[model samples]
Target: MGEGGKRKSRQEEVPAPPSHRILTADELGLLKVSEVPAGDKWEETAAKQRWGLPDKAQGITRLQVHCPDWDPDRCLVAAARSSGRVTLHAGSDGGDVGSFRAAPPASTSGRSDTSTNAVQALRFSQPEGSTQLLISAATLGGHVSVHRCPVEAALATAAAGRAVHTWEEAARLQTISDLQAMDVSSSGRYLAVGGDGHQLKVWDLEVAGKAAMASTTSSAGPDGAAAAAPKAGEPLFAGKAGKPSRSGLQDLAHVTALAFVPGQDDKQVLVGTAKHKLWLYDMRAGRKPQAELVWGEGRITTLQPVADGSRIWVGNGRGHVEALDLRQAPAKLSMGHALKGVAGSIRALALHPSEPLIASVSLDRHLRVHHSTKRSSLAKLYLKQALTGVAWLPPLPAAAAAEGAKEDEEEQARAEAEEVDAAEEEEQQDAGRVARGKGKHSGRDQQAGGGSRGQHGKKKDSKRRKQ
Candidate 1:
C-alpha cells in the first residue's frame, strides 16, 4: 500500500505524464477565431453561463442542440448536467425555454429504485410531418424517457398565463444498461443506439410516434377496466419493434461512437468501437458487419459521413481527425484534410445541418468550428469550462442564416471602410490646388492686360497710317 491505503502502481512511481502545449490560432494558422470575452461579457457570445451546470453538482456531461433546417422555431439547444438536470433553451438566442428532471420511472425494477446519477445519453428528434419534437434521455440505470416538446404552444401558454409548459412526456423507453452512444436519423424514422455488452439497436421512431398518438385517443382499454397507462419509461421495443444489425464478432469492443449512413434509406450504419476500429453494417443484410476498417490508434469518439457517401470523417482521441474512403479495395485513407495541431482527445463532433461547418469539443477546453467543405480550421474558442460535448443548434430558416451572413458582410465592410485610400486622397487635393492656382493667375492677367490691350491697338493703327 502507498500513501492512501491503495496498492501503488509501478507507473505511478515514474515521472508525471508529459504535457503538450496548447497551440494558438495563429500558431495553428487558423482564421476567424472567437475567444470568450472576459468577465460576464461571455454570456453574449456563448451560452455556457446561461445553461451552466449548477454550482452544487458535477459538471455538465452532455449537450444537444436542436437544428431544424426548415422554418421550425421551437426547440433550440438543451444541456444535461451530471446531477440529472436538463434545461431546454429555445428562440433565436438560446434562452432557458424549459427545465425538467428525469425522475426514475415508477415501478421500474422496484419502488426503491429512485434516481440515476446523471444522464448518460441525450437525443432530440422531430418526427416527419410532426409539429412537436421528441426528446429522449437515457440514464446510467438503464431507464430511458421520451418527451414531446411543443414550442409554439408553450409560447402561447406563457402569453395567456404566467406559467408556460413547453414539453410533455411522450413515451418512456425500457431500461438498457451501459448505453454508450445513440443517434437519430435525418428523416426521424429510426434511432441507432449502442453501448457496452449491448450491440446496435435501431428503433423505428415513426412507429413509436404513432403509438404515442394512438395512446392519446383511447384512454381506457376495450374491457373498460381502465387500461394500464403506458409506463413513463416503458421499453419501446416491447410494442413497436426495430431491426438489429448483426456483427459476427462475439468479442466485440465497447461501442464508443455511432452514425447512421446516409443515402441508404436508413438501411446502413457505421459503428466505431473502443478498439480503434470501425465496422460498417447493413441492416438489410445479415447480422454480421459488412466491412471493417482499422484506424492506426486512439478510441473513436465521433463519426461524420459525407453527403456523397464516398468519404467518412472520423475523430478520435489523441487529437486524430482524418477521412477514410472505404470504396477502394484496401479502404484508402486520406491524409490531406486531417485536423492538425490539435491536442487532447475529441469528446464530441457536430456538423451543421445546412452550413459547411463542423464543431468539435475536446478535452483541451477548446471548441473548434471547422469548415466542413475545405476541412480547414475556421474558428476556435476556449469557453474556460472543461467541455464534455457539443452539438449544433437546430438551424433557423434560410432568412436567419442569410441575415447572419449579412451581418458578417456589414462588419467586413466597416472594417474595409477604415482602410482609406491615401493615394486617392492625395490626388484629389493636388487637383484642387492646381485649379485654384490657375484661377488666381487668370484673374491677375485679365486685369493687367485689359487696359494695355487698348494702347497696343492704337499704336498698331498709327503704324499702319505711317506705312
Candidate 2:
C-alpha cells in the first residue's frame, strides 16, 4: 500500500476520542434527570426483581465498597438491607452480583421485641499480600462477624437464591449491645465498635486469629479430629467514660460513628457521639480522648477523613455536613461553608475516590452531590425509598475510564501550554526592560556630550571676543 493508504489504516485503528468531558460540580448543577444515562439511575422495582428480593424487603441500610489496591480489577460494592441481608453489586455498573443473609431472621412467636436485628455497619478488608477478602458485618443485636472468602469465588456466578460462596465465618464478637457504629482499620489488624453504651472498643485481629488457631488445636479429640472453634474475642482496648456533669449525672454520650485516622498506623481514631462531640483517641496513649471538639447542636452521624488525615467531613442529625481541619489546635470547621440541599438527617456520606465530590444520602430520600471545595450542591436525585447509604463505585467502566483518561490528558496538555506561554511572556517582558534601559543610557550620554561641547565652544568664542 502507498503512504496515504497506510496512514489512513493507522488512523482507523485508533479509537475515536470520547465526546464527553470529565464530570464537574458546575456541570452537574445544569444536568437534568432525563439527560442522565439509563444505566446511572437505579430503578427500584426493576432492581428488586433483578436481585430476587421480595417486594416488601427492607430498604438499604448500609453500603461498603471493597476496592483493594493490590488488585484494581477487583471492585465490589456491598449494600446491606434492613432485613439482615447484604447484596453485592458490580462496582463498574451497579449490577447485582450476589446476596447473603448477614443476620438471622427475627422471631415471630408473639415476642414483644422492639428492636430489629438490622445491619448497623459493614466494612470490607483485604490484607496486604493476601488473595482473600474479609467482610465484617455488624448487626444491631451486638453481633460483629467477619467472613472470609476468595475474591474470585465471591464474585463468581451462583445459582439463584444462593451465595457465590459458602463464606466461612473467621471471627465473631458479641461484646457491644445496640451497636451503632463499627470500623475496620486499613491494615486489617484492628476492629472498632461503639454504641449507646458510651464506650469505644478496639479488637486486635492478629491476636484473635492466633487464639482461634490455638483453641482449635487444643480442642482436638483423641481421634485427631477437631470441630470448628469459636472465634469470639475480647476487645484489646476499651475507652472509659467521661467525667460527671454539674448535675452529678453522666452524659448520655451515644457513639454514632467511628473512623481510623489515616497515616496513624491504625493507632489513632476519631469518634463521633450523639451529644454533638467529636473525640480523637490514640490507642497507645490510654483510654481517655486526647482531644475533643463540639461543632453543632445535632447528633453526629458520620465521619469521613481525607487520605492524609488532615481534615474530616462530619455529618450531623440536623441535616448539616461540615469539614473540620484536624491540624487546628481544637479542630474547627475548615470549609467555612457547610454542604447544603440535604433537607433531612444525613444517613451516610461518601467521598469520591478521584473527584472533589461528596455523595450523601438523607432521610428525605434524596442523594445529593456537593463540591468539596465550593461546598455547593452539584447534583440531587430523588429516590423513592428512604435513602440510607450512598457510596462511589470504584474501577469505573471502560468507556468512562477512557473518557476520564482523555480528560486528564487534555487538562495536562492545557496546563503545559499555559506554562510555556507564561514563560515566553515573562521573557519578552524582560527583553523590553533591557532594551528600554539601553535607550535611556544612550540618551543620557548624548545629553552630557552635547553640554560639554557647547560649553567648550562658548568658552572659545568668549576668548576670541576678548582677543
Candidate 3:
C-alpha cells in the first residue's frame, strides 16, 4: 500500500497477464483409485455426501493413513473414534482393509464406563526395512500398539487381512497427556515423538533386533571416528524431546508434528506446536531445539521439512501455509506465503520430492496446489469432500536424476541458510541494545515477531549481503 497507485500503474503498463484457466473435468488429469471401487461420494453435494459428519462425530478424535510406499492406491486408512474402535479401510477404490477393535485391557476397561477412548494420533514405522508397523497412541490409557503390515495381512489372509491384529508394544515412555505428536523418518531409522511435556524422544532401534534400520546420525568412533554396535536389543539412544517438566500441557504447549530432513546424515528434526511455533533440534548437536523457525501466526498443526532439510513447509490453524527458507541471516530474513486466506485450518501438507509443487489440505474442505517458483497458484482442486490428508505421488522411475537432485538440494540449502542468517543478525543487534541497558526489555519484546526468537536457528550462505 505504501508504494501506492503510482507503482500499480507502472506495473500495469508493463503488461496484463492472461487470466488463469480452470481446467474442466475432461481436461484435468484423472484421479484414479484402482484398489477401491470409484464412487461419486467424494465429489457429491451435501445432499448426496455426508459432509461435516466426521467433524460432528464427537466420538472420533483422530485420523491416520498408512501407505507402505508413496503409492496412494496401495494404502490403508484408519480413523480412531472416541468409542474405542479403530476403523481401517483398504482403499477408496475396492475391498475393506480391516477393522480392529483397540481398547484398554479387559481388566482396565471394567473400571470405566467410557465406550470409546480418545485416540490422539497414529504413525507407521518400517524399522529394519521389512513390513510396515502401525502404531496408535490414545488419551486415557496412554497405550501404544504396533502391528506389522504383512503379519496383519497374513492373519487377514483367511479373512483377507481384513482382521486387524494389534500387538501391544513396550509401554511408551510417556502417556498421551505427555504426547504432542509423532513421526517416523523416511528411512525408518528413528522414531521422533514429542509431546506437551517439552521433550522429544528419539527411539533408535538400529541395534534393537534383526529388523534394525540404519541411522544416518550414527557416526564412527571417537573424534570423528566410528562407534561400536549397540547391544542387540537396546536402543542406540532415547534422545530426550525437550527438557523434562513436572506437568505436560501446563508446562509446555502441546507438540503437533515432527519432520526429519530427508537424505541427510545429520538427524535434524523439525518440531511444530499448537502455539504456531517451530523449532529445529539437531540430534547431532543437542537435546533441545538449537535453531528455531519463527514467523508470527496463530496455532500451527503441521510442519514438513523439504527434502533438503534447509527449507520447511508449515500449515497453521488460520489456513496459512508458508515456506520458511532457513538459510538467510536473522537481519535480512524474508518470508513468502504459498497460500493465504484459506477457508479452514491447514491441517495436512505433502511436498513433492523433486518438484517445486506442494499439496495442502484444509479442514474447510479444500485442496490447493502451490508452486514454489514464488507465490503463484499453479492449480486449485475444489473437492466436494473435505480433505483430511494429501500425499503427492513421488517422481516416477523414469524421472530419476541424481545429479539434478544433488544440485537442487545444495542450492536450496544455501539460499535458506542465507535468509536465516540475515534474520539472526538483525535480531542480534536488537538483542545488543538490551544488553547495553539502553532499554532493558524492548528487544525481548520484539521476539513477538516470531521468527526473531532465535538468531542462529538456521544456517547462512557465504554471499548474504548486509544492509
Candidate 4:
C-alpha cells in the first residue's frame, strides 16, 4: 500500500474475521439444518423446493391415488394425516386440491380422544362401469365408514359462495376393537378387516346394501307396528382364534397389514402379522390360511402385489423391502431381490402404474425410488420429517405434457442466452486488460526517450567547453 505513496484502504488495513464461527446447540437447533448432514444437503434442499415445507402438525399416515375412468385427465391423491385429517392433492403437481373430515363429529356430552379418532387405514374403490368413487376410511376405534361421490364432479371447484360437491356417507359399520388393516375387493363387493384381536373378518357389501335397503322399506308387523331392522355390521366370514398350544397364547398373532392379489378377481388376500409371518388366504376356501411364509427380518409392516399377480412386495420393520414370487408353490415361495440403502423401517411401499419402478417411505425421513428389476436406487429425497406413506401419481395428460415441454424449451433458450452474454462480458474484460498493458509500456518508452535526449545534451555541452 505504501509502494506508490498512496493511502491504504480501511478494509485492507483491518484484519478480517475467521471464515467460520462456532454455534451453540440452541442456535443450531433454531436453524433446523443441524440434523442434515453435509452429504445430504443437496437432497434436503431439492425435496423442500419440490414439496414445499414439511407439515407442522402430525406427519402423513397414508397416501392413495385415484384415477377415475370418467375423467382420465385428472388424478387425485388422498393423504391421511395422523391428526385425523384427510386431504386431497392434485396428482400432477402435489397441490392441495381439497380436504374433508374423515372422522365423525364429536359428541356434545363427552370429550373426544384424538388418538382413537385417527385414521388407521384408507382405501378407494369404484364399481365396474360406474361413475361414482367410493372411499373407505377406518379409524383406530374400529369404525369403518364408506362415502360416495361422483367421480367426474369430485375435482371441480365451487363458486365463491356456492357449496361444493362433497363425499356423502353411504354406509357405516363397526368391526374389531382396534382396527389396524383393511382392504376392499376389486369389485367393491367385499371388505376385509383385521386388528389386534387376531381375528380376520370379511363383509359382503352387496348383502349389507340389500339389508339397508330392505330396512328402509316400510313393513307392517304382527301388531300393526314396523318390523325391527337387522344389524348391518354383521360379517359374512370370520376367522377363528388359534389354539393355545399353537403359539402358547389363547389368540393368534395380530394382523398388521393386508393386500389383495391383483388380476385374481380378489379371491386371494395376503395378510401380514406382527409375528414376522405372511398368510395367503382364499376367499372360496375356509377361514384358514392356505399358505404361510416366515420372513427373516422384523415384523411385516406393508404388502403390495404387482398388477399381474406374479409377485408381491413386502416391507418389514427392519428396513428391508423384498419381492416374493407368487407363481412358485406356496411351500416353495422364496424371496426375490431386496432393495437396499434404507437405514430405518419402511412404513409403506408403492409400485408405479406402468414403469418397473417402486417407491417407499421410511422412518429415516427419506422417500426413495428404486428400479424393480435392477434393485438399484434411482432417486432419494431427504424429507425433514419421518415419512409414513408414499404413492405414485399417475402420469400427466398428453396436453399437459406437451405444454410442459414447451415451457422447458423456453427456459432452456433463456439459459443459453444468459450464457452467451456472460461469455461476451468475459471477452471484453480480457480486451480491456490488454489495452491497459499497452498504455503502461508506451508511458515507460516515453520516459526512456526523454532520458536519452538529456544524455545527448550533456555530451554536447562538454564538447563546447573543450573548444
Which candidate leads the pack in lDDT? 2
Tens digit of lDDT per residue, candidate 2, span 1-467?
A: 99999999974553332211111111011111111223433222111111223333455667777664422245566777666777676543345666676774344456734245678899888788877888888888766667788877665432334344566767654546788999999878798989997489998877876665577577767897643323446679988655566889866758999998888899988888888887888888889887777778888999888887887898998999988777762334343458766678888888876678787777776767778988877667665556566665433445554554465568779999999999999999999999999999999999999999999999999999999
**RMSD, candidate 4, Å:** 17.2
Stretches of candidate 4 exceeding 4 Å from the true structure? 1-45, 48-58, 68-73, 94-97, 155-164, 209-232, 241-251, 329-331, 395-467
Candidate 1's TM-score: 0.60
Candidate rank order under TM-score:
4, 2, 1, 3
Could you give me the TM-score of model 4 versus the true structure? 0.68
Which rank order by lDDT, best down to worst?
A: 2, 4, 1, 3
Residues 1-467, candidate 4: write the lDDT tens digits. Answer: 57544554632342221111111001011111111122323233232113334554545567677864323236666767666667665545445566666665565557777676677888999889988888888778776667888877665422222224567777765566688898988888788888886567888877875665466343545666433223355788776543344558653659988888887777788888888777787777777777777786587888888888889999988999999788964556778788978658878888867678787777786767778999988667665555566665443444544554465568778999999999999999999999999999999999999999999999999999999
Task: Name the best candidate (by TM-score).
Answer: 4
TM-scores of the models, in the given order? 0.60, 0.66, 0.54, 0.68
- TM-score-superior candidate, 1 or 2: 2
- lDDT by residue (tens digit), candidate 1, 249-273: 3445477788777677777778788
Sliding window of 10 residues with minimal summed lDDT for model 3:
20-29
